[model samples]
Target: MLSELQKETAKAIVNIFETGSARGDYARVTLLTGDSGHLTYGRAQTTLGSGNLHLLIKAYCATPGAAYARTLKPYLPQLADIDLRLDTDWSFRNVLKEAGGDPVMRDVQDDFFDRVYWTPALASAKRTGLGEALSAAVVYDSVVHGSWIAMRDRTTAKAGAASSAGERRWIGVYLDTRRDWLASHSNALLRKTVYRMDAFKALAASGNWSLDLPMMVRGVRIDPDALCLRPPVNASAIEVATRNLRLTDPKMSGNDVRALEEALSKEGYAINRDGIFDEGLETALKSFQRDFGLVDDGIAGPATRLMLGI
Candidate 1:
């Protein structure tokens, strides 16, 4: 099972790619504020309600004992104590008289924006240019928080008994050979089950789990709408997991084959989509997974699906 963080990371990357399509500019904002510092949306002259630099704090919290824990530290030096007071004007008038323009804020804005616009959605997608780090920051929140889930069916819905007095009939000795369904599982298995508990509850009780957005502005339309994390189906931008050569069968036709070929090529697997996975095709698919440091299983599973970027 993948971590919520991992899924969020993927979702964020996807969103940035999608935003670039609609807005022509998907910015990466690196708040030059402290952990508990307040983040507000204020125009050059207007003011907005304060929002705790909650996203940043959540990022740090997600990674418990990371060496480079605070994501904003590299950008906001001389980090002040976490003060979540909203509506306090950034005294630029006094700031200008005391010291020149804010070097930190300027630096953060320049770097963050540059990164978001420059970084390719895929890991190491750059070819012949400077790379961006903050682009990774835009999707930062989506890939971290827990998503709601629930059980699709109820357990122990039926009980069996003989007049409430269960009796065992004489039977031959029965030897068990099956192993426990969850015995000796990896630690990740347990963590994933625990992580999705909230979603499980929501599904068990209701049917949907919603993400708690960091408050949205009233009566105003925010680009990349604050509500939806996933991209719209009609989004112009498409995700390509990787860039490499791909192959297709001579028998395959038109756009269907074309789309599959492109998707697979992005995953570094080139195969002719001649409506069949022949011997050569199977070998190629397995080799592609191997090259990606994936489980080289012949079957194409979730990881491979992700690689296909669908």
Candidate 2:
């Protein structure tokens, strides 16, 4: 049976990829293309080239005799015919957003992640004799971001050493290999997103193979068994308390930074939407603070969060 920790590890991976943190299914529009070389959105990190658009349409069509699905049925051919890369167009995005509102998109995401990613990952973990929470988490992420065949091939190639060294050591080996693969990938965008590998390395370094202790991913500390409610659909911003947030703090990451950066950008402050609350982000935060009559302390506490509405 899958343990609760293992399940949360899956959710946590999704959190890191989709929202930067473990609280919500925040909508993100980072760029036409970024480090991942894919247009990304929602909790599942659905990318344009990854057949997710096709999956969404199929998912919508799967609903039996629903008007919404039927309304979109006519456009299925158009959706299918359009090049995934051309989805960068504003018109295409608007149509996609309309067709796949939050509820349907969540459904599609759950379906794809469960069927296409997590199920295979879980099965592969069993094959590899992996039972640790962190190991399962890593496998799931590999399946989601890369593919089962590639990860399996790599694992098999490294199996001799991993078998001798045990599961923990195998995880380290696998992560190192994955990092190298990403760094040397043909796609420059994929190559630049090696931070995902770095994050996993950090998790392994902490010796929490079972993921029983708190650890960081994408600068956010993930406490074992920590539970967070998914935010409502189309939520403009997330509410935060004074606790668990600070400039350069590991806890202050994920959607919080994305939200802050987006808000600042709207008000004419330039910042990267990488989701890390670095010094540049701190400076931008202070600029926003000074303008909004809040303390320019640069810590994203309750007051600052409220002022930014994120």
Q: What are the clashing pairs of model 2? A: 20-254
Q: Which digits, one per residue and each the tens of the lDDT, describe model 2 over residues 134-251?
A: 7888877765565444555676687654456688777877878777876786655566557766777777787766666466566565674444433211111111111323463343
TM-score of each: 0.23, 0.61
| Cα-lDDT of candidate 2 | 0.58
Which run of 10 residues does model 2 get worst, by summed lDDT?
232-241
Which is the leading candidate under TM-score?
2
TM-score for candidate 1: 0.23
